[model samples]
Structure formats: C-alpha cells, structure tokens
Target chain A: METRVDGRLVRGDQTRRAVLGKAVEIASVDGLEGLSIGRLAKELEISKSGLFAHFGSKEELQLATVRAARRIYVTAVVEPALATAPGFSRVWALSECWLDYSQRRVFPGGCFFAKASHEYGARRGPVRDYLAEVNREWVQLVEQTIGEAISLGELEADPAQLAFELNAYYDSANLASLLHDDDGAIYAQARHSIRARLESAATAGTALPWRSGRSR
Target chain B: METRVDGRLVRGDQTRRAVLGKAVEIASVDGLEGLSIGRLAKELEISKSGLFAHFGSKEELQLATVRAARRIYVTAVVEPALATAPGFSRVWALSECWLDYSQRRVFPGGCFFAKASHEYGARRGPVRDYLAEVNREWVQLVEQTIGEAISLGELEADPAQLAFELNAYYDSANLASLLHDDDGAIYAQARHSIRARLESAATAGTALPWRSGRSR
Candidate 1:
C-alpha cells in the first residue's frame, strides 16, 4: 500500500521551520523583542497572514523560536558530546563542542540561549519562564555529566559546583568573544580555564582527558 | 566670596542625576533599548524637551546611563574592596562585595554591567565599544588585584587566567540568581567556587583570606 502525504501540510511545516530559523538568528543578535512578523514576512517573502497562521501572536512566535533554538542547541552541543565515551571524555567533549558551537557562530550571534536568557532574565513572562526551564535542564545535564565522571572515579568534586564553574566559563567566553571581537584569545583563555579546572577535579589516578591524545 | 554654585546649573545637574538614576534601573531590567526619552519623561514627570536638552539622541542617553551605572558600580563594588588591606584579603573582599552588590539588587535587577554588556554585546557601535572597554578595565582590575596577592606571596597563579575564571563565576551567578530567583544559594555557590579557586592558588605559608577571622 502506498502512503500519500499532504503537500500543503508539508509546506506548512517547512514554512514554520524557515520562519523559526530566521527568527532565532535575528533574536540572537537583536533579542526576541526585535522579532516582528512584518519584518520576517518582508525578509522571507512570505505573507504576514501565513506567519500569523503559524504564530498567533508575537509571544507565541518568540516561544516557538526558542523551542527551535533549543532543538538546534541539542544537535550542535548535546548530541556531539553524548556520542563520546561516558565519563571524563564525555565531559571534556561537551565543553569542546560548546566552545566550538559558540565560536563557529552556530546561531550567527553566539549562543542563542545565553543572549535570550540575559535579555529575559529580569522580565517576568512566559518567555522568561521557558528560558529558565531550559537553563535548569542544561545545568542538570552538565551536573549529570560530571556525576558520571564522579561515578567512574575519574573526577572528585561536587557535580553541581563543577557544572556551575564550567558553564560560567562557556558563557563568559561566548560574551567576550562577541563583545571584544577577539575570537582567538578569548576562547584560548576559556579553554585554559576549563582544562585547568577539570584537571583540578580529576582524581589522583585518573587520566586527564585534556592531556590525553583525545584532547581539543 | 565663598564658592556659590549657580542655582540653575544645580537644578539642571539634579535633573540629569534623577533621570539617569531612573535610566540605569530601567536599563538594568529592561535593557538600554527599552529606554526612551518620552517614557522617561513621563515616568519622571518632566517635559520631553527637558530630556532632549540633556540627551540629544538615544545613543547619548544610553551612554550617559552606562556612565552613571559605572559610577554606582565603583562605589558599590570597587571602593569597599579597595578599602580592605591589600593582598589576599583585598581580593577576597572584592568577591564578597561584588556578590553583595548583586544580591542586594543595587540596580533592582542583578549586575548592571552584566545585563547591559550582554544586551549590547552583539551589536556594534559606541555602546558596544564602551562596554568592551569597561569590561577590559574590570578584567585588568581583577588581574591587578590577583597580581598583588602574588606579589605578597599569598597566591600563585596567572593573573589573567585567574581573573577570567573569577569574573566568569561572578557573571554566571548573577544571571542564575536573576533567572532562578534564588539569591541565597546562587551567591553561596559563587562564593564557594571563588574560595575554592583561590584556595588552589594560595601559597603554602599564606593564610587563606576566606578562612581568616575577617572572612565573610
């Protein structure tokens, strides 16, 4: 039996994807508040009505853009690191992938979550709540990764504390790179900080992932 | 004749001070882009023409607001730390004062520079340039403080590297506190990271400032 797909529905999904792709990029540089259906329609050559159909309101569009960005983030940062061997290597890989993601301009404006989170951090709204939830999830993921290293006796430290420090390095590097327009030294500094911090946390007998051949 | 201040000049200066006081608070929360002369004039119960006289353009207003915030930051975070004895105690005091500044909501948000820096980081122009300059100034100050500790044989670490890590912790904690609305634990976590990092760098004979009777 041949399965028939509806072309209109497929087009709708494609349009939504395209809109969100553009939305995330704009929002990364200009903030979510800068997103407008009119601008998107003009830039993308789509009807404003089409965008309205996809997103009932500006907040809805912003929320959808964030979700889209999260998906992109997982693919760019999370999955690559997860593919590595569990334990210290995975943790190191996560940091490398994150730095690469930011350095590579994965969203054309550095880390999407960092920009949006800062923009909405002080505001109380659905967007802020959603970003906070995403942040909590990311922090937990980093903590869990460190917990794996701890379980394997490869690291010795509080998972949450190490996670906090590592995440801070990632964000600080990202912002500095963007602001100072000096991609080279800022990332090198962050890499130095991360490698040194991880070295401190590594157990006495554990092989240092960064010093190993697998290091970035 | 005693130095008599001009009455009209004093009134104009007072108005400028009042406007910027509100501007920094609003910019800290809503971002500099959220600031408008009309909105400020309405909120401050002043004429739009008056704000126009003070700030000929939006960029001028933003620059003034940033300058104002820096003055407040110096008083809140830098001055108190400078009052402490040099070496490890001064470095520790800087961290404590910075955490307190953020936790106390000096700007009714978190760190004013953190929010503003992240807001204008991606954008180019005078504001971004000024922010980058301010950030460099801050990083150098931290580095110089660490150099003092190293000179006193109280700590042993690369000034730039340690400064980057410590600054990262401060910013990460600031953002987390704002987003999570958990001031107490977030600050404790930052303090723990800072103290631990400093402990790692402290010399053998040097007393840890955080462990001393003068510790926060």
Candidate 2:
C-alpha cells in the first residue's frame, strides 16, 4: 500500500528526485561547480524558480546533489559489499563492486565522490566541508573493513595504510577508465593490483578471495 | 643589452605571459573550465578583447595554460630529478621531487595535471586529449626511471607495474594533502610506502636512498 501523504508532497518529492538524478549525472562529468540550477532546470524541463524552491541557493543545490550522489554510491558500491561476511572477503567484494560501479558508468562519468572530492578539496566552504565528511565516511568504512580482516587473522597489515592503497587503486582505475574511454582492462589491472596487495598481506592459511566457489 | 625584438611583439609576449600566469593559478583552484575570458580579463584588469586575442578562444587558453603549467612542472619536478645520475638514484630523486613539489604548493592547488586531468578526464575535447597526452608523458617518464633502476641491477621488478604503483602513491599523497590541508606527514607516509616497496625490490648491496649525506 502507498504510504499516506499529501498528493502535493508526493509530487514535490518526485520532482526533487528527478532533479537530483540529473544533477548527479551532470556533476559527475562537469563537476559540482559546473552544475547550474538554470541548466538543470532547462534540461529537466522545469521552471528555474521551481528548482530554486527545492534548494535555496547554488551552494545548497551542490550540497543536495552531493547527498544524492552519496545515496546512489551507497546502493551501488557500499551495500553490496556490506551484504557479504565481514572480513577479507567482504573487503575484496567492496573493491570489486567499486570497480564495477565505475566501469559500468553508474554515474555516466565515474565515481562521483572522486570527481567532487578533487573539485572541492582545494576550496573552502560548506560544500567542501560536506564533501570532506563524505570522504572521511568512505575511508573509515574501508579501514573498518580491513580491520575486520586483521582481527580475523586473515590479513596482516596496518588497516589505514591498506585502506589508502586500496582506495588509491579504485580512484586511479576510475580516472584511467575515464581517460581511456571505459577500457575494461583498466579495471582488470586494478583488480590485479588489489589481489596482489591482498595476497602479499594474507596470512599463510587464509583463503585467497579471488579463487571463488571453493569451500573453506 | 636587452634581447632585440620588435616593440609590438615584446608587448604581445609580455601580455601573453601575464595572462597565462594568472590562467594557471585560476585553473588550478577552479579547474580549466572555471577559467573564462571574462574572469581573466576582469581579474587581470585587461580588456576582454585583449585577453581573447592572446588565446583566441577558451579552449586555446586552456591548452596554453596546460603548456605553461608543463613548463613550470618541468622546472619544479622533472628537471631536478633528471639532474641526478640516472638509475635507482634518479628514480628515488624523482619521487622526492614530486612529493616536494606537491607539498610546496607548486600550483596553489595540488598537482596541476592531477587537477586538470580529473577535470577533463571523462569529457572528449582538445582539453581532455592534451591532459591524456600529459598523463602519458608523465607515466612514461616514470616507467623509464623505473627501467633505469632495473637495468642498473639495483632494483628488480616489472617497470610498468612499479611505475603504476609509484605514480599511484604520488597522486594519492597529493589528493590526501588537499583533503588534509597539506598535512606534511602524508608525504612522509607516502615516502615510507615508496621506500618499503623499493626495499622489497632492491638488490643486495644497493644503498638505501634515504640514508643520505653519504657520497655515492
């Protein structure tokens, strides 16, 4: 059954979602700075005043777009990895899903966070602060996942350092794919790099994550 | 005596240099697309037509800025590394120089190429093509440096793979610096990673590069 809500509220929510969907796609390629309410409104066939009512200012619009991207990022990249068991296997799944998300053009550019982070990382303001917070959230998730493996005795390394390298591989591959016209092999190379790094850190009896379908 | 040049040509050269100098700084903080003739003219207090004549178009201005950045990059990062005797030492020197360049805020952003490349990586245009070329040149130079180390028998590893990982560290550290407010120690951690990786591949009796002040 549909949740009880005013018809006007439902329509407004739908419109907001539609705007953000287009917003994230534009920001992914042209950057958050490139996202303009006027262009977005025209493209969405909505009134500029209508879109402006959803977000009070350009900065607000950018922040909302970042939040929208975060939700998609969670669904496409994070939730699937979290669905797996917590440990090295889950961490491996996270990398795989991230690579898939980028190469599949989930955002029609690449990872939204990577693009926005670089865009705002050098700037100052509420937008930069929010993007940094999102970045911190993502990095912490990666570190925590690695920590699970270390606790399980499946891996041996500093969680922060491994997180850094793993995240680096993800971003490098994302940028490389964009530059190379979504060349599939870049993802493979990233996978190889991830697998090699993980293999180097895996404990002697730990099952390698890449060799799937074998009973532990 | 002043180098002889046509009086009109000298003024033209001076204007072009001044325009490019501001262009690189703005492009660094705001990406190449953020740079516009209007902004350049307003900021430099030059007429719009004057700035427009220097580059002819926004795309040409971006390419000229990239070229200007390249010259700065060569002087700041590449030349210092090249001055050293080639081989493992030069590879080590290149890493140090790159890290230093980023830490020193050579572009007032992070790395110029990193910012511009991420800006245009997904978009198809002369800007993206030029960025890709710059990226290829940087990566190939890195590979050649690694090759020198391998050929000298001081290091043993696949040059391509090593180049990828090393460049990854450089770019990662640069981005992390932006995110972390130029936290000086990220470079140290990246240095540590670079050293550890090199140590793993280094042959017996090869002196560690970091143990400096000892004449080679």
Give me the candidate number with maximum TM-score: 1
Q: Which candidate is the best by DockQ?
A: 1
Residue B4 in model 1: shift from native, Å?
3.6
Q: List the residue pairs that clash in candidate 1.
A: none
Against the native chain B, what TM-score does each candidate's chain B reach?
A: 0.96, 0.95
Among all windows of 10 consecutive residues in model 1 chain A, the one with the lowest summed lDDT is: A207-216
True-contact fraction per candidate equals 0.78, 0.49
Query: Any idea what lDDT model 2 has?
Result: 0.89
Candidate closest to the true structure, highest lDDT:
1
Candidate 2 segments exceeding 4 Å error:
A1-3, A212-216, B1-3, B212-216
**Weakest lDDT window of 10 consecutive positions for candidate 2 chain B:** B207-216
